[model samples]
Target chain A: MKGMTIIVKTISSWVKVLIFLFGIYIVLFGHLTPGGGFAGGVILASSYVLLMLAYGREFAEENLSLPVASKLDSVGALLFAAVALCGLCCGAAGFFFNFIQQRWFAGQDRAFDLVSAGTIPLSNIAIGLKVGASLFLIILVLSMFRPDTSTNEKE
Target chain B: MSVPLPVFVAVPLVTAFLLPIFGKKGKSAATFLANIATIALLVLAIASIGQSNVYKIGKWPIPLGINLVYDGLSSLMLLVISVVSAAAMFFSIRYMEQYTAKAKYLSLFLLMVAGMNGVVLSGDIFNLFVFLEIASLSSYALVGFGCQHEELEASFKYMVLGSIASVFILFGVALVYGNTGSLNMAYISQAIQKSGLNAGLGFALGLFITGFGLKAALVPFHAWLPDAHPSAPAPISAMLSGVLIKALGVYTLARVLFNVFGVTIPIGWILVVLGILSMVAGAFLAIGQWDFKRLLAYSSISQLGYITLGIGLGALIIARAGKDITAEQLAWASLAILGGLFHLANHAVYKSLLFLTSGSVEMATGTRQLKHLGGLAEKMPVTRATCTVASASIAGIPPFSGFWSKLILVIAAIQAGFYWVAAIIVFVSLCTLIMYLKVQRYVFLGELPENLQQTKENKGSMLVAMVFLACLCVLMGLLLVPGLRETILTPAVNVLTGGYSYSADVIKAAGGM
Candidate 1:
């Protein structure tokens, strides 16, 4: 996939990949550090924003549509609700109760480890998905209506 | 009994940060996740009710570190926030289609909810200010979600006033800290009790009243509300009008006045005056509105007045314990408060339903002007039915939620020998009825507009949202039934009547000094 991309007129293609990877890193480490779903999501969307700025709107549009983004938003919210509902199913009293605390899963040691803190890790991932998709989709929708600078200059 | 109150704030705080990662590809996943967070919050809120708990943040004890307090009042507010946000989130599934940035909107919405939940649960005064700002700032941005000329203008106005209110609250907090040497509300209350209200405390109280009054959109400070509330999208309008003002403005004012500073006669009278003024002025202003949502906004001010009056009257009755007034009068005062809270919840549900229905109308017919909209009932049966239920409830028609609450308020007023206040309550109810009737006649009962001849009902999640709130409005009266009343209203009322005992209760519950 990296070898196939030869269309960027400015900046190395590796830079874009690096930026995307950094965004993913932020999202994954959200719970452990300052950057979580919202920050990480915005970071992820910026990669696409960079792609649009570098590769143009056509490339972005071919990859994602407005309706598809809306659907992602619905699904993300539903997933968040479902995670909370798990607590209720276990008779733990409320949504998002830390029911997993009693169950011992592999790799669930350490205080700040992803899966160690019960529902926090799962909730964080759900939020990251919602925020990332929402940001990117909004950017796409905005970009679709962006004025053509080339045409404006010609006119 | 030993639950940490901070979890309410911490969960959403964490989730809000985490939601953005899925980016464009995971928008559906994001929405699902946000819903789950709120549902979890809802369960937490319900489970926490009737149980008084305090969690000191960072394991630091109160007076040194911030604490979150959950009592009847906080639990009640939490329940209202959860129910309304859940409905709003469900509605947003389809309603947010016309707008872009669905994820950003949801994140902000959850943030606002988290802020309100925090405000209600926070035992620290300064922390309340922080949460209040979080909620207010998000709301201001949300109001202008459309970025249209009107929405932008309204958002700016709301931001300006809201910022000013925040400043006032912060100033009040600073004064309280300086005067009492404490940021914890219970500690401040204890300090005030030790050394009664000094001039600085007095000034703080005045500032608090003005700040929260502006937030509540009381009569004098309500200019921005009409424009701001109508400008937002439907579910947003619902959330803002339904619970935002009550949670941030009214509930905070009641908590600070009753719990922190301690209520006095002069302060009590001031609240009563503000309440009555808001009621009369809000209803009168609402009667003249041609826009459907704007009318509801004005009515919100009026309804809030009832809550303020109920609480203020309770304070006055307690403060004026003399040879003339007896314990029965005190009980009557409590009854009045119970009525006010009941009305507050009822208004939140029905008002939000009304706004959602208006959104549906606007979505279908492309306009919200009462003059332009006509006979939508024929086309949009679901909206029409829901609107009818909400309108009847708001109008205080028999068997609907509003009527029972209003009745209780009036009866309490009369029993407490506040006959004039009772008359005023009835007068306001009549005006409310007239305004809603005008809405019904112009928007639903009149001849269908030629342009809107092909209007159809809003289907899917929107219909479900409206139906849910409408059903709640009708069934809410059942809350007055003996068994249910003991569970919900009595617990909430006990929290308020408990007054200064709140501190002791919290300390005892936490096994502290």
Candidate 2:
């Protein structure tokens, strides 16, 4: 399909950056707030989806290629798993996902702080990355089915 | 020392994530790492046998935090899963090379393994459901990996039924949590014991049976298995047929029914009927199939019937008599459970081997149609030998693993004074024999199709994987010997026969009961 009208494209270009930033904020502060990885990740993915809607498929592909998105998805997941493994022997009882501040941060009493909620924030970041990449990839791939886009262009 | 429960799941999850990074170019490295991860899991499973532990995740208390529990049943399931998965992974090292995106296949395979491990080891009901979804979703994608028309069709069919089952299960879990105010299995059991089966709980139980029975592919709920199993890559077919159904469907059914809901006579009898119907229907249907993998898929339903029947019989007697049963009845129940558990392990090995051999045939000949393929015995001796061993084991020939499990099932049924059940079991055995004989005749003994004259045996990792399972089929009878039985089957039987103790054990492991 043709790109959106110039006015729509121009507005989306400015608004999309705000959406991406808001998603990052939510993921970073997930442990202390209502919004978490999944919520934030979808917000992030929507920015890209918005880009595709306004700028057309080719523009979106130019910005974030399929292979790069796929790689980022895997990297996000691996990062999550790695974070879990790092704390495998650190839980108070030595189980997985034990990100107690005292265990790694050494007896610091930093409650209600950004980095004080143990491994949760790190995990949230990893999940946010994964979910965002996955959603973006899904939307991009699905968008390839349009009448205006040939299958070869998807590759 | 006991291994931590989370590692059972974590290792594979980590491996799954890592493999995809290797991508299109580093396929060999990806396969090598995947193989190592599976072998490591097998070693871990074997090492952790007879050991039990509850790992409190994030260091929180049981009711507050999710925990992973590994006990007799968990260990048994872990053993079966890792064994079949290791073999399948090994086989796929070579078998999957022909398919593009081998890295993604290996990654998905490991994801499925991780999901299965989580399902088996999970102490919380909702955790089980999450893991179940993870495994089911991966298997669906893997089934349609090649993106062929038939593969996509089969995958879609399997996905629709599977999703329906998952929805039913999630609904049941919701009902359970709403009723008991808890999602932990042990707490749910305790609450149920205190309150008894109210209307909501009863509804949940029905939902559980429908959901799990669908996953197990019991007759009337088994429309997807024949199509889905044959469409996947060979090793995946082996994994799906071998342990996925048992771990996801039958194991969960047995666990929830006995340990959580407290097995009742009615539920027990229903399981028996379901088992019998699946057995009879699967056998009759399998006999008429010309597609080699389709026949194996039907036979999976038939063999799963034996496992279900054995468990159901034991459940019937135990549920009827409770803990105060007579010694003879208890003996019969334990024997029945033993037979069921043993057959479960035996089936995981032989059925996977059977599927892998079919895979070898397909890889060599490019088709699974029985009529169009024959005289592979001369060209593919290792595959033929492994296939014969597997067929013999499944057909319940003398001294094979299948014979011993069947013998135990018959003896248990007779001792329980269910003579008709024994007769039906024998009749099913005969039908199984006939079906395999047909497989042998058309697939091995008949004239070779001209198009397949240049077929050669699949070598390397495929051969090794097949031989490993084939040898296991021959040696599995040792599990029935008194000393080995004490080490293996008895522990698993104790887990089931002592169902009332499950909550107590979990509570004790978690802390003061």
Candidate 3:
């Protein structure tokens, strides 16, 4: 299906990229600020959703495609889990998340810096990627069943 | 050796993400990895048996940090979850081959396993709710995996009810945090003791019973089980019926009621009434169903009732006790709880085994309706044999696992002067016997349907899975015998019977308050 009016498409094309960049900022600074993986991820998903609404389905598929989104979703979750597992190698800290903040690697002196908060920022970025990929996939799949105009069957 | 508790949840979560990466082509490798994860959990669970520890996340102290507490009850639940998951995953290796998205299926399976492990190992209320939602969501998707008309309808029904239950639990957790000013269960227990039940705390407990009770499918809240359990693929049916309800519903309910709230007479009576109602109503409803898996689903509610009844009886005795309580009464209460926990373990094995056999039957003949199946004893001999063993076990026949547990329950009821409860218990066993006999007569004995004539026994991993559980059915009697009881059943019972000791146990394991 073709997209909306030329004016809406032109504005969305510009605005969506800005939304995408803001989402990255939220995820990267999750530990320092209130916005974390979940907030950042939703923002990221919305940016792509805005593109799909402004441009047609065909245009969006040509960019990221389905397989790439699916693979990226899995990669994000795996990355998050891998960060958590890295804590297991750092002595008797518990399982799901035990980041290494002390032991000579990442010092506590520079707590406010981007590299601080042990694994929280890394976890946030991974979660942001996962949430963005998953939400986009859900939207894309739902869009496919929306009465394909070229076909005759009543989807 | 004390296996790191986080490994239980981590291995599955990691593998769940990794398996989906295999995508469409590497299905065999995906299944292999999934099986390895479940098996490793089972081995770790075995090693962690009878071992108790508290691991503080990031080494943070209690009341501030989330600590995973491994205790008697946690280990028992861990043992049950791992055993059934390992068996179910093995069975799914071949059984799920017919489904198109095999990799996605395996990933979802691992996700469900991770969620359950988290539920089992979690030491706080909020994290429990999080893990509970993860497991429930994946299960809802898995139930509709076939994408058939019935499966979709059933999945939607299950999801609506399940989401409501989750909301109730979350609300209760919010109220708990608000009232007690803590999220850690041990701290909450201590706070509740220091300040008795206020209005908010009482309301929270009410929400908990309703939420967990709905998840467990106790009578009035059981509208979804009949449709949902039978709609899923067989292995999933086994997982839901065998362990999901227990870990999500019974375990949490028991933990909160006894440990956090500290059982009172009113709560004890409520549990008793719910137990009896579920038993009688479930049995009555089950005896009339012709769908093989549907019949088994109703039977699950009924069997769960017996466990609840035993626990309730024990709780009643405990709550009624004064400072000078009699030794005999204490013994009776302990016996009741022991019966309940024993039945829980036995039922997990036999019930999952029964579902697997039913799956084999369905796979062979392409239907689960009893009227449509007959004389499978001649064609699928192994499935028929395993089905018979499971049937006898569930019906409380002597020498099977169910008989021993029910016997303990009856003896405890009679000893405690609950003659009517004892009578009802015996009467229900007869009802159970009649239901399974119906299953045997219609599905295995009567004239074979012409469509099912070509049906043959399922081979490979399916057979291995069924045979392993069938052996367990015959051997579970040894669990109640004198020596083994000390290690297995006693610790679990002690956790409940110890009652107030839970707070101290947690504090001590965490290296002090």
Which candidate's lDDT is highest?
Answer: 2
**What is each model's TM-score for chain A?**
0.76, 0.87, 0.89
Residue B248, candidate 3: C-alpha displacement in angstroms:
0.7
Candidate 3: C-alpha lDDT: 0.90
Best by DockQ: 2
Looking at model 2, residue B464 earns an lDDT score of 98
lDDT tens digits by residue: candidate 1, B111-183: 8998998899888899999999999989999999999999999999999999999999999999999999989
Instruction: Give the DockQ ranking, best first.
Output: 2, 3, 1
**Number of clashes in every candidate structure?**
44, 0, 0
The sequence of per-residue lDDT tens digits that candidate 3 reaches over residues A54-155 is 888878888879989999999999998888777777665555444556655553487878888778888999999999999999999998886447566545
| Per-residue lDDT of candidate 2, residues B1-513 (tens digit) | 778788989999989989878778998999999999999999999988888878787667887778788888888899999999999999998898789889999999999999999999999999999999999999999999989999999999999999999999999999999999999898999999898999999999999999999999999899999999999998999999999999999999999998999888999899899999989999999999999999999999999999999999999999888768998888899999999999999999999999999999999988899989888889889999999999999999988899999999999999888999999999999999999988888888888888878888888999999999999999999988889888778988888888868988888989935
Candidate 1 chain A lowest-lDDT run of ten = A1-10
lDDT of 3 by residue, B72-133 (tens): 88888889999999999999999998889988988998899999999988888898899999
Each model's lDDT: 0.83, 0.92, 0.90
| TM-scores, chain B, all models | 0.97, 0.99, 0.99
For candidate 2, what is the lDDT? 0.92
Ranked by TM-score, the better of candidates 1 and 2 is 2
